[model samples]
Target chain A: MAAVGTPLNRTLVRVRKPFSEDRTTAVVATTLSVLALTYPLIDRALNLGALDDLFPIVVYILLALGLNIVVGFAGLLDLGYAAFFAIGAYTVAILTSPSSPVASWLPFELNFWAALILAFFTAAIFGVILGAPTLRLRGDYLAIVTLGFGEIVPIVFRNAVGLTKGDQGLNAIAQPNIFGYELNSSTLWGWWYLLMLVGLLIIFMARRLRDSRLGRAWMAMREDEIAAASMGIDLVKTKLFAFALGASFSGLAGVLFASRYSFANPSQFEFSTSVLLLSMVILGGLGNIWGVIVGGLLLGVFDRILSARATGWIQGLGDATGIELLEKVNLRDSRVGFFGLTLVLMMLLRPEGLLPNAQRKRELEAQATPEGEVRVDETLYDKRGEPL
Target chain B: MQDLIQALLTGLALGSVFALIALGYTLVYGIIELINFAHGDLFMLTSFAALTVLEAFAIGRGSPLGTKVGALFLALLVAMLFGAVVNVLIERLAYRRLRNAPRLTPLISAIGMSFILIQIGQYWKGSRPLDVPRVINRLDLLGPLDIGVRFFLRDLILILVTIPILLGLLYVVNRTRIGKAMRATAQDRDASALMGIDINRTIAFAFLLGGALAGAAGVMYGQYTLTTDYQRGFETGLKAFTAAVLGGIGNLNGAVLGGLLIGIIQAMSERFLQNGSAWANAVIFAILITILVFRPSGLLGEQTPDKA
Candidate 1:
């Protein structure tokens, strides 16, 4: 930052690399998208049960991709991301569900289509509200404040039985409509397809932003806020945008989640869920979008499908080996421990994260000396009560 | 006046407990600038450790006063030692290598450590809240004549256990060589190393002392609340952390002040206001956010330009 020439360029451009450099990457991405799109159709034809499982994981990947913008690109550690997710879902529920007071109070309740648009903006507004007060604090302080915000939102929702219906939660969310046609809810492929398209578009937009001046400003702030500020980067605007955009993505996923489940409950979005999303981004590799997608997919599948199957496998092993310990221990029950371990091991072994961005990798691995020391003059305020 | 006085005393009792844990957070943060996220969980484990030791000794209210106090003393000592060792182990295993790498690395690892300790607590004790063994009797110490409120022996005992530890922490920090090394390192690690201070050892000792404080707090917490759960650390530790920040993180006396103030506020809110029980955390957090936004330095914290 002190030196003005060639500010280290790290683009979130993994998907768009020339075919010559990464033929496999492009091909695999194409094949995956095509497969993801067509899988539900195949599920319909074969009557497969596994396709139903993809819904949650796909939505989570979308969430992780959104979070990646904040933690990965902007270097803001948002411990309370589930707050935005909650905001999104609750917005949709209140707007669309007939039982909701808002719906009845209005001349007519908005449809699912209208609520989705409202959810995005409402989540973004909440994102700003949460982000505004916290911009000046450093990493851990920012994190803790976000954590508090995260805790407060759900608690408020839970307590406000008058508004949120308390623990009963809002139910009977209408099946989503698409261009005047009612989509089939029993067969979830249509929703899955919609979510997949949204995820792809966000990822694409994120990639473009990575190369844009605003993304560079974010990188500047993330790399060193003081230096970035010295270089005239608007720290407030950049951080807020990161929070706003990151939150909007989570809101998108929340709407999808509420619609599909036909219910919006506070319990569904909790600290553990936030931790799960964060682990996905951190383990996948911070700052690398493709890596985040990979991280989300691996962990999602593990958490959803493999973890349950692993429990059975552990039981089978115990039965075969006659080891009482394996039978006594349940991996699913201990999955939180697994997540905790993953975070610690990942940070220790590779602080750069799994599949780190090229620039983020260089910076993390570079043993970059601590940014120019904070001095008395640079302190936010002074003893005489004058601002520094 | 009666309600106010009652709230005041209750807040102070709770504050003393918070002060102990907040001291640990301040100590670690002052030296390493790493918020030991696991400190709260470490305190949780120490309570379980104390319980297991007490169980092994079969000491209870039924025993003679000396044996009862002695067994409880022994358990406290064991918990202190266990907490100190485990804290150092966390530092040595997870943090020592990342000393110079990056700030975020150790922090992420610390979070990971918190989760691990929480799970261990869950597995050791069941997930449900366990009723803490009443080692200390619950007779009201402050009167036959009700002053419109009761200050139980439990509150007095809480003060008895906590105050001495606070005094000891002050003595160690103000008077001892390890304490001096810690101060020097906190001021400037590289400079302290140049001046022949064993920086690593100093940092390790900081964790040890921090762990000891956390362990001591854990026992008091269990005794005061009469229940322990795995998630106890998440709530208590977070409150303590808020205290540390409120007191001006890295400022020793500030932590004590912050803890007392927070304890009082929580007590007052819980007792005096409608729906205060549910709103206490939200209110406290609102204060935290307000402080960070309006006055990041906190009530007693000085602007330390030299430190990161």
Candidate 2:
């Protein structure tokens, strides 16, 4: 039976590879770069303010990439990635605040570049602190513990009245400046577009890392920890690196976020934010860099479009119908309902995601059974073909 | 000394509620190895049910003691039924289909379910805290050493009532045929199924039992706290989950111990942390980190065969 299935399975696998060369990677990168460069121009020409919409997408893309390193490559489930984002935002807030000492020491002022670098280190340090004890545990345990950390961080920031101003939030955070030219001009789209360029650079680096020895080791650990360890992978060091590197991306995104908003609040770093970011990674397809980018863009665009128009759309429908019941529908609150529904639908229909990672696509396809039968039986078989 | 005693008592009372909630987590996890994140929301719903029922009766309108007691029992039964139904529905809709999906999928579904419950409650209750009626009379007692223990008669009664009931639960789980089947399913679902156990039904029963316990805890919590809100479940759920982890995820006895420990720690941390009691979460998480570092499997959690 096994011999009979081998040729058919190989044929099926062969038909699935769409773009299979360095040429494809080059084409993707070039197209993305061209699009990134022309985005602001397109926004201005179309009079659509697309740059404003694209800003958060860029942030999310960076974040999803960061999370991809840990959750995707390293197979570490981190539900608290927002804590690192918070660290980045807070670091910039504290250092660049008018009352802070860093303001006096800097030649010009605390700007985006400095903040971005500092945010990386600050968030990375916290990542190390969180990872030190919990990294030894298995996946689910790490997820729960990280969740605890995520919940606690925001609450601590909110309640530490003396330091964090107890929910009023830190405001008037300094914006980015290039050389002597201030990037804080009304045309903030320029700075955001530049950030997207920087995001592309980070993506490039990530792609490189994905194909590197460290990336291979992380993937090996994710697939089989004992096997990876036996093959001379230092579990502690590799896990910490994954955590630290993953955190650094969020940290970078955070600094950019504070600069973009010119404000930082504890409320912004809630579990929902973490979930949203996780959704992006999952939606794109875990462990796939390109998938993460696509997922981020899709989620960011969807959220923006829905939030801006959902209320109006509902009100318009109410007006058209002349029904008072429809008028009372608060689309803002309904957004969460939609989010829940989307998550459930996506998990059920597209568990491997819209753009699954290469390995995940293969695995999901292999485990895909007929619609009625439970998929567990195929996946549950041990080495001896007996159920555990 | 007086403050310490009061804090300890307060902690114990609070811990009892946590223990009750934690039992739901432990029980569900034991059977299915899945954390029912929506359990806290179910608890919140139960509290709302109790509040609504109590308010319906003239108990809030100064009805007599007998009327109030009758209302409370009726509310408890209704809430328990609601919990059981909700659990069954959740199993059928969200968890049943994902039985073989990656672990993360079910967990995420649980989170999604939690948001749905919270949103539905918010929509129903209008996002404000519902005031629980002050129907139970307070009774103070002084012990032998002039201990001056001011125990609320209602709370004391609840603790006394819950203890035997939980013990009865323990007895059922350990001594009954159904209980043996439950354990067998937990140990090996396939093996249990081979031996003629209906795996899905057993899991549903586990969820129903867990939800019922959570329902009871919700009513008790509402009575103690004097208010119930949609957002209450998130924090309460986190704390209970932490307790379940501390005691051992799948161990009933561990959950009880963990809950009490967390309650006491939370109370003491609030008392001692000088910056206006806001460091409660920080302290609790610190304790959690310490425990995870020292004992990742938790105090009573036995090592299971690695499925991952």
For all candidates in order, the CA lDDT equals 0.83, 0.78
Candidate 1's residue-wise lDDT over A55-91, tens digit each? 8998888899999999988999998999899999998
Error of 2 at B74 (Å): 1.4
Q: Which stretches in model 1 have alpha-carbon errors above 4 Å?
A: A1-28, A41-48, A368-388, B58-63, B306-308
Q: What does the lDDT read for residue A196 in candidate 2? A: 71
Cα displacement (angstroms), candidate 1, residue B174, comes to 1.2
lDDT of 2: 0.78
Clashes by residue pair, model 2: none
DockQ of each: 0.48, 0.45
| Model 2 chain A weakest 10-residue run by lDDT | A377-386
* Candidate 1 lDDT tens digits, B67-184: 7788778888999999999999999988888887767778878888898998899899888988777787878866788677879888888888888888888899989998999999
